[model samples]
Each structure stands twice: as C-alpha cells, then as structure tokens.
Target: MDETHRDRDAEGRARNARPRDGLGRPLPYGTEGVGRQPEGVVRSPEETLREAQRLLDGGMPFHAHEVFEDAWKSGPEEDRELWRAMAQLAVGLTHAARGNAVGGARLLRRGAAVLEAYRARGPYGIGVGALIGWARELAGRVEPPETGAVARPAGRGRATGGVDAAAEAPRLRP
Candidate 1:
C-alpha cells in the first residue's frame, strides 16, 4: 500500500496526512493547515452583506470577493450592478494586497464609478458616496507612475509595499 494513501478517516477522507509547505515538502504530521472555503449561494441580501463585511474586516478581501460574486450572480436583476461593484472593490483590495498597484487602482475606480450612479439611494442602505470616497483615497495612495511602479503608502502594516491594507480597507455601511 502507498504510504501517502495510508491514513483515512471513517468517512474515507484523509486523516493523518501531513500538509505540504509552500515548497511542496510535507510538513510535520498534525500541523494545522490554513484553508478558507468560498461562501455558497446566499439568497438574502442582508446575509450576503453581513458575511462580506465579516470577511473584509478579517482582512480576507479575496474571500469577501467570493461572497460578493455570489451576490452578484444570485441577486435580483436590478441589484446586479450593486453586487458586482462591491465584488470589484473587494478584488481591488485583493490585488493591492498582492502588490498589483495599477490593477488594484483601476478596479477600485471602476467599482466606485459603478456605485456613483446609486449615490443618492444605494441598495441595502449602502453609503455609495462614502465608499466611492474611500476608493478614491486608496487609488491616490496607489498611484502608478509612467514607469508602472506602485507606491506603497505609509502606516498600512503590509510588508509587500503597497497601500496600507488595514487603513484603506473599505467598510460596508449598515
């Protein structure tokens, strides 16, 4: 029997298998592995917003984007733009975290622009204007010069040299 296939739980799922490190080397047995599952379909707007906010607050912008994408895919037709814009904003933050300043700034501005149309009365009471303002400020911090270099703003606590993730992270309005 193959050693790699030796450990299995009652349900036949891998049990005592060692998780791999970034280099693909097997980690010590019992080492905890970090994993996040993308959120499933959420029909309620309130629930979607709440989950997205929780993810964003936890500094998991990519996960937040998944939640927003679900909303965009499953929400009412009239609210498609709203959900898409929110997802775009989350992706923008994700890109910034990954050190893609130009891409991040572009998505941020695009998301803000989409929300600007609903500034007077955003869906689900979202503060469109405030969100747009935040996006603009973050974009300013990530200004990509002609050389395509992204500027890292001070005080963001990120070692990747980009916008301050915590400082520039968007807050969803209740």
Candidate 2:
C-alpha cells in the first residue's frame, strides 16, 4: 500500500476524506469541516424540500445539492425534471460561491429553464412560479460581467456567493 492511501466509504466506493468548508470546498487534511450529506438516500418530495431547505438556510448549497441530487436520482420518472432542476439550482449557487461566475450564472439560468417546464403542473405544493422567479432573479444577479469586468474587487479572494444561496434560495412550499 502507498503512503498516500485513498479514502473509501464503508461500501468500498471512493470517497474524499478531506474536510470541506461550509460551501463544500475541500480543505487541507486535519482541518475541521461541516457535516456532509450522505449519498443515495431516497426521500419523498416533501421531505426533500424540508431537508434541502434546512441545508440551504445554513449556507450549505453544496450539501443541499447532494440532497437534491438524491431526489433527482431516486424520484419517480414523472417528476425527475423537477428534482433535477432543483439540484441544478443548488449546484449553480455552489458555483457562485466558488467564484466561478460564468458557471454560476449559466447553471442558474439552466436550472430556471428546466424548472420552468413544471410551472403549469408542478407537483408537491411547490411554488413553481415563485421558484422560477427566484432562479431567474439569482441568475440575473449573478450574470457574468462584461469582458474584463469582475464580480468582486481585487484582493478580496473568493467571495461567498455561497452565502447568497441562503439569501436567494426559493421556498418550495407555498
């Protein structure tokens, strides 16, 4: 075995043991990190909404993304679009937090488009129209700057648009 052994979950799948910041950014080994969402849990739409909202409220878009991802993967085919859209929005916020303006804006817009399809018949008491508006608003807010423009001033390092995840997150329930 090499000195730099890989981390593996109990099921023998590769998992990064490195700690992560609140936004899910990996930190150096031995640093303290927030709790990560476990992978592969099946959740009802309502449950997913509650849990994802809790995570989002705590400025943990990346973790909320995982929750939405599990919903996307595990949800019924009829509703996969909704869940996938939710996941995309969460990840879009994650990108923003990571200071990837282009990616953040793009994903935010994409998620809005995807979620828009559900406006008429969106399920689970979701405020589809409201959610769409929220996504679009965030997308517009995080839109990439003009050429040579910067989202943040220099020397600020990476901004926590991740924190914006909490400020701008949509309320799935009416």
What tens digits encode model 1's per-residue C-alpha lDDT throughout 1-174?
355566886789765556643212356666654344344576588888888777777667777788888889888899989999999998888777667777778888999999988899877878788899988888777755544365545433233465545556677893
Clashes in candidate 2: how many?
1
Cα error, residue 46 of model 1, in Å, equals 1.2
Please identify model 2 stretches exceeding 4 Å from their true place. 1-4, 148-163
The residue ranges of model 1 lying beyond 4 angstroms of the native Cα positions read: 1-34, 147-160
The count of residue-pair clashes in candidate 1 stands at 1
Q: Please write out the lDDT profile of model 2 over residues 48-77, one tens digit for every residue.
A: 999998998888889999998999898889
lDDT of each: 0.73, 0.79
Clash list (residue pairs), candidate 1: 156-164
In candidate 1 the C-alpha lDDT for residue 172 amounts to 85
